[model samples]
Target: MEPSDLAGMALIAAAGPEEALAFIRAGVSSSPVLEVEMTSLLSEAGTARWPGLADALGRWRPRLPSLAPERDMGVMERLGGGLLIPEDPQWPPALDDLQLNAPIALWMRGQLPRIPEQRRCIALVGSRDSTSYGANVTGELASSLVQRGFTVVSGGAYGIDANAHRGALAAAAGGGASPSTLAVMAGGLDRFYPPGNEGLLRAIAEQGALVAEVPPGTNPTRYRFLQRNRLIAALCEVTVVVEARWRSGALNTAHHAEGLSRSVGAVPGSVYSANSAGCHRLLREGAAVCVTDAAEIAELAGSAGNNLAQEPDAATALHDGLGVEDLLLLDALPLRSATSAEKLSVVAGLGMATVLAGLGRLELMGLARRATNGWQRGAV
Candidate 1:
């Protein structure tokens, strides 16, 4: 590996994934074997050589001391995985939307399928302790997406993530094309953090791709898991939160998707379950589209999905419960011009008092309204 690549890897190892941008802003080049003079950088942080870099470096100084770039490269080689830098063809282009916070490099195993466009990728994520309802919904959505040629992306955690990967695999086995899924991990590819998911991760590495921002041999941490959510969001064109609590991390992924201006979808669940609280919150806040099936999610990929299906005409039932007098008044009311109650009475052949009462009811029901001349039909 190049010296700059090794240095960047060690920097990520020391600073964790979140600080990649900080390292770049501090005068460290991302590649071409640029040497990072930590001693001089720290020295300058204390002096005027780099005034703004002080605060950034002081907080990170203590953490940068334990890094061993050479050793980490050797570990990665032994693991048989490879690094994916931005210049590499395998690097996901959608991540560029993250700007400075985008991953400096990805440590990947297996091969990434060729994506015609980032919109063709979808992220199906939810709570780690998902319920059966969440799992079933996620599996159906993921399988449907894979069958339609979308690549599924998710964190390699338990619950919904596991089901999503399994769904994609099942679809592929049932004669779906390749490029089924990608599992972005919170830890190094060398060690799958949730040992319980070893079998699933192995299948992914064999079928799709297993990727991480952290170097080999690194352990998973709470912070890393949170940071990994952005990758899940950025790697795909749409993110679906199948089930999550009010404070679940899956919401964080959806937020990242929103920040990137990507479409967000949430599945409704039983109102009583705390597991569905986040999805409900997302819908209520207008942060996500209430998606019930794969066809709805497929619409987000620019394909003709559920949204294209003809919907019921809301106006057709706008006057369903109105009384006969009210209906008559509404029908007789002018769509563009206004008509006085006396004129409406003559047009509908009703008495003046009855016409007045019916007009009032129609107005209240939003089927008629007072116009400049008199009463007019409401925009139902």
Candidate 2:
């Protein structure tokens, strides 16, 4: 197909994805008018938005005739993903704040989550090589945030990102209208990066959404990871750093949040912990708010006196009479990944028969789910 006839993402990319203002300034708009504006942007006078616009669009002009979007779309569709441009109804208005750096289009898998308000989309980022303390804190924070009706957003990588995603999924398993989490991937949705996070990424796509700027087949390079951080920051009103060191990439995300004029929150770690140095730095520099829990995070992102997390009723009927072994088993069970009966026996300090029996009971009550991979923590 001709470049003008190309899909929204390809047309925008070829027109000038790198030069954020080129197409918008040329009045290249909605899905219906993208093709027509291809010529509009190419015309001599239309490149006046920026000095480089003319050269940028000019360079793509000849190559437009040879562009092929149909093939790409076929591949994307086979993967159950499609393109998203600013004109799309599901487009997050918060991203427009990026202004000159806004992405031309997004390659996404699954539905884009729509929180009640823009600020309801909260981002949690932190050190990739995190401590057990950091991971536990991050998971609790992420799970609590989602339970409060806010959608958690994070990069789909190791450490903090993985825990954040797992925590969100764990909350979702309880079965309510709480918003689903979103993962803005550094690479293409066609594949998961870090290799280890494949299952978590897949669950997020099935339960929430996953998005990327580049098309399918793109590798996750270091530069791309940095670029993706901007999207994570811009997509949310509040970005929280659960834990980070002096040179952690999570700090980069906090900087992007500050640059975009979004709220930044830092979770304090042990005074001498190297993993928490970056958060301390942000707090010391007064670049981030000291947020110790999900409620504080919600307050920072939400408006005055609203968007409050639903306090669990103290006298609720759920789990009123569970035995000690059941409680311990619940605590030891994982939220997303599976584990074996023997592993559960060891972790919960129960016999194999006891672990197996509890797994069966929890599974029946929707408190636990089973897979050979392991026993999953069920919602209480």
Quote the positional error of residue 337 for candidate 2 in Å: 66
User: Local distance difference test, per candidate?
Assistant: 0.78, 0.78
**TM-score of each candidate?**
0.68, 0.66
Given candidate 2, what's the lDDT at residue 10?
37
Residue range with the least summed lDDT across 10 consecutive positions in model 1: 1-10
lDDT of 1 by residue, 41-142 (tens): 334334224323343444445556566667777777776667778877867798878754577778887656442368778999999898999999999888
Per-residue lDDT of 280-348 in model 2, one digit per residue for the tens? 999999999998989889888877686565665677655556788887887788898988888889989
Instruction: List pairs with backbone clashes in candidate 2.
Output: 338-373, 338-374, 339-373, 339-374, 339-375, 367-378
Q: Model 1 segments beyond 4 Å from truth? A: 1-51, 59-66, 113-116, 303-380
Rate residue 291 of model 1 by lDDT: 90
RMSD of each: 10.1, 19.2
Q: Highest TM-score: which candidate?
A: 1
